[model samples]
Target: MSAGTGQRAAAPGPSTQKPRGIDRVLAFVERAGNALPNPVVLFTVLFGVVAVVSTALALADVSVTVPGTDDTKQITGLLTGAGVRWLVENLVTNFAAFPPIAAVLLMIMAVGVAERAGLLETAMRATLARAPRAFLPYLVALVACQAHMMSDVAAIVLPPLAAVVFKSAGRHPAAGLIGGFACVTAGYAAGFTIGSLDALYTGITQQAVAVLSDTHHADVNILANYFFTAASSLVLGLIGGFLISRVLEPRLPAYTATADAPDASESEDIRLTPAERRGLLCTGLVVAVYAAVVLSLWLPNGAPLRGEGGALVPSPLLTGIVPVLFGGFLLAGVTYGFTVKTLSGSEGVVAAMTDSVKNMSGYVVMMFVAAQVIAVFNWSNLGVLLAVKAAALLKSVGLTGFGALVAFILLVSCLNLVILSGSALWSLIGPVFVPAFMLLGMSPALSQAAFRIGDSATAVITPMNPYVFLLLALLQRYEPEARLGTLISRLAIFVVPFLVAWLGILAVFYGFDLPLGPGAGISLK
Candidate 1:
């Protein structure tokens, strides 16, 4: 099959433009990357490797002392009869109950209603269609940064929306698609406000910390990275806007508008009518009402939403974030649909939900194999073992201060090239990274903040991100010559600006040793 996107092969079309030095290098990189097997196959190979290695290490009697205590964990061989049986018994159940599986699918179902109702698209189109020419790029970047609140749906929705926004302003739709995808992926770990990501990331972190600590609890507040994330979002938007207008916009080769794209003359006329305007207002009111009801539950002492002892941070409200987001979208979508008459009755609602699932079929298939790999890795205790080793090596070198954080960020960045799923990568590394940092006097949130920087900065350049594949296909509509290499060259321009801004944000937090978020500090002490 093709790469992570599961797309069919294409016939050659227009000849490619000759490349210079970096383009040539990136082109070579693209060849090498695409030469590799599909992500599902890659993950399958990874599973086998983990299995073999676990057996070899176990046979060698390899073990490590858990850092905070005297207890030792020996590497368990997945090839052993006991190990194989354990894997067999839990394999199906593990995939069924994988944490991200439930969160992502639920988010899709909820946000799908908003999307299918046309509330999201109409509202965005209305706002961006009227923006000033110079201000449009910055505004799109800003919105892209905050789109994390839309959850997994953000990945599926924002690129096309941004394309329309650009096309409305008489710019290349392909530039909008490429740049929008970059911004959304780079903005994943960072947002103007807390979103579904924080909840999902926090849940994985809690489990990681629980593996090694009794004293230092991971953030119960989903706002753990909010302070850093919000700041980075603004920085990325400003710099991204500048680059988009000057760098990305100029670099795209000329192309005629495809049938899928509206002509320049027609695109300039894109706008919302009165009906859509009313629908947006109704949607806003519905969302507001939903938020008010949810918050009121948390206001009362020992209420259903609050945590133990009437605390808000560690509450069910915090942990049950996925459902809260689900409700908000469901209500907002239905309200907009009814107002606009796009949705008629209960049948329409169900049809909208069904369409959402149809869109997510690819993601669902990918997650199934991913779940199996993660399950086997956890069962083998390889993640813990790797973390213990990493901690020891880092501590021995006396790596501390901002340098330690930088090293960790860089490591994750390199790995992002191969592993595109943020949750999957975090889950694999968190068990090792979190506890190890805690041992070095760093807070779990600090390591997490560092991870956010790494996770986002390189996504634009990586061919492996499934969303990148999605964007590439969209780009090909206008420029049939646009291969992965050409797309990478276009996307690569954003990397330096993104990395510099993200690092600068991290440095501000690191140098001052400031709080990373609500009640979350840079160090445990």
Candidate 2:
């Protein structure tokens, strides 16, 4: 809520400045994107399209030579007896075995409980309050850049928290809310820590790699892009903060209290209560104890968490990270909830977890369709065939190096306008990109890193994401006449800035032949 009555002034409207060239581009992009169907429907349609295409290719006797091997792979018609049985037998299994399903759910359940118990809210709010006012935007931007670890909870959580933080610092709340929304959605791959999203993206990437080669291939883990992404958080965070504070806020109209307007503070303070403080203190202890337990299990070469001969990357500790997060959040959330009376008993804890799962209902529906489409694509040999063809083309053009990487980033960025789900987009394209790049002696990690840039840079301005509408709603509180166009224009300003910064970071990493993360170098060699 308002830090003072002076802060109770009615929020002003969005800028009345004339539309810029970028605004028109965003408008056209938004219109084209809005014409597409929902992701679930899109994926279902894609499944049918893939089946028909597979049948056509099969009838045409299409096949490709597997790279680095003498094996010939042929397209199989999805309408044939074997194909029909594969689809029928694997439909349920496809969804059940989908790589991201269990991981996303485990993550959501844990983050949800922490959110429900108010631990996340209190802790983040405290962090925001302690920061210098001049650095508020940077802090919010940085926090948002990392919030995906909390999964979709970040979508619902960060905006309002940001608003409160901004209001406390005597700045326009809309800037914080809108800026936070932009950073969270667009700069998703920019984070200092690995979280659920890493699992979701890499899980699909691993599946794609697995389907590409019959022989053993390098596996993608949650840490595949860790090193590069952590650096991106700071770079993009500064750019975002500079834009929001210096450019956007300065353009906002003046504020004045109005009886008809909602209270800027709504009479709430961000400071934690005595109860919350105690709860947080208890949660800290829970975390420390959990850390100690993890260290005990990981320190020894013979530990179950360690890999063969105690390697880290291929170890259970790395592979099973989502569950590890689930356990930590569960311990922290339950501890705080019970301590604060937000959760009364065992039933309360279970209920919190249940509510978190409920938040994933829509995603579950989308995943079901996506799983089937990907399954068919792999089984029909479309991904492998495309990879071979695309790789051969890249090599022929003498562009199978950074030129290819740059082109891949641009392609993914353009597609991101209409394809709202990063996981969905990657699932569709990763199979092709991973194998194609591998054939060029580039690692899947490099391909994945390219995707991170492409997805986030354009995703910031896309009207296709449902969250954009939610962001528009939040802006309407400050600017009652605010429309999707208004938000789109604001979002447009950040697109190039984000893209340029990301490209710079990517170029540096690529030029230096740096590791994207542990054992995930830019080149396969």
Candidate 3:
């Protein structure tokens, strides 16, 4: 498969005569992107300063009064202080923790192989190849949201693919960009399949839930939100598509008149080879076998995916789900590559893996900044204070059951702007609220699910979400004039529908007393 984007203006040779209109816009985007503060550097510096100051203040006993609480507590300080070796160790260990990271890596491995083998591109081209031009926006967003399970491919790869797809379909490339990013950002929380953030958040959540509930019980499953998430994915995807086609596309500056650009001007020129096709078939067969095995292990009486009593929805396999997405992508990617001749031997496989890791260099850097910031927040007890204050306010409102859960989600979404990291936020909130809600007869698992929906739904609109900014930087490729507020505002409209749909689904699940994950239910037993 071809890389989904146009390379650097095809070398600016004959066109040095200067650009007009849209070309000028494209040029401005490129220049502005290069000129912006490197997000990585900026975050590192900012986080470092915060960590240092927080650490120093913690040691000096300079404590802030806990909001809404009569008790004062000492900050843990940074993990690096004299008596803080365990804190430092926990940070390092958390960063190095597997399961989630490994899952992401494995999924990408297979997906990269599939991408290299031309499977994804062919599939993308083929899937919507016949879709009516009107449905393109919905299709792009839907596909991009699902693409989250494929690592960071959507952010880096999909928008350009979207532009090319829109162009090939006789539509404006700008519309494609908008549609693609919408899915990537807005669908951030709605993955039906496994995703890295899903794994990370689930893992952290289980630990957090244990803080107040049964410490020995691993009650929160990683895929606790899957079934409902899948349904909403389709809903939001369609909504985003309609909004773009009817509203945003018409208003975009570089509007092309037709639904698709002529095929002759398309950039990638990717075609599936016979071997690649065979490889894809083989990959499908392998997946089928894999699923069968999983079913054998999980669908039989007392299968892991089922609940303690053999209920399908609340299965352990479903809850503690280690999204095999990593492995799935790796296997699919390698299969496609080998079948398509993009990969020749073991050497090719290793190289592809290397390249995949290389692509993540920036993420690694960002993670360090993110890690330090979260570490400091925990050390300062700021996150706990925030969670406690909010939980108290929520309790005092006299709302109960689903109304309370809905309010809790809204509160979490607002808090998301400041906290940004779902796990960190949940780590603070879950202990306080999970059991608190459980006391009110809500399942801890279900509360965890609500927290996730709130966490993800607001990610696209929040400036504090590191990935949102990174995505905007990527968006500049097509819309150089795109501003943060413009992007967020456009996204905000989508969020209203997304939040509505998400809450609606939660209500259905709760009303039915549906299982949220393995041995987990919407209401406490």
Which of the numbered candidates is closest to the native, going by highest TM-score? 2
Best by lDDT: 2
Per-residue lDDT for 1-525 in model 2, tens only?
Answer: 121111223334334556678667766877787887888888888888989999999999999788778888899989989899998888899889988898888877887788888888788777776677899999998988888777766877788778767876778888888888888877888898666678778878877776665743786777889999999999989998998899887877774544534476652567778998899888998899998898778777787787887876578876777788789988999999999999878888889889988877888898888888878878899878888889999989888889998889999999999887788788778878888898888888889999988988888777666677776666666766666656777877888888889989999999999989877888875
RMSD score of candidate 1 (Å): 4.5
Candidate 3 ranges beyond 4 A from true positions: 1-122, 213-218, 253-264, 267-276, 300-327, 354-393, 415-439, 461-492
TM-score for predicted model 1 compared with the true structure: 0.82
Point out where model 1 deviates above 4 Å: 1-19, 148-181, 193-223, 246-261, 300-302, 358-380, 427-431, 463-490, 513-520
Q: For residues 1-525, what per-residue lDDT tens digits would candidate 1 score against the true structure?
A: 153222223534324544567656645656666776766676678778889998998899988776667777777899999898998898789678766566666766767777778877686677677889888888788777877766656777777777867877778787777777778777778886555467667756665665454344555456678889889899898877887888988877875877755456656445777898899988887788888899899988767888888887667876677788778878888999899998987888888888877876765666677666666656666766776677788878877677888898888988777666677678667777887787677888888888888888887787656677777777766776566767777888887778878988889987898888866888875
TM-score of 2: 0.90
Global lDDT scores for all candidate models: 0.75, 0.81, 0.62
**What TM-score, over all chains together, does every model reach?**
0.82, 0.90, 0.69
Total residue pair clashes for candidate 2: 2
User: Candidate 2: global Cα-lDDT?
Assistant: 0.81
Backbone clash count, each prediction separately: 0, 2, 30
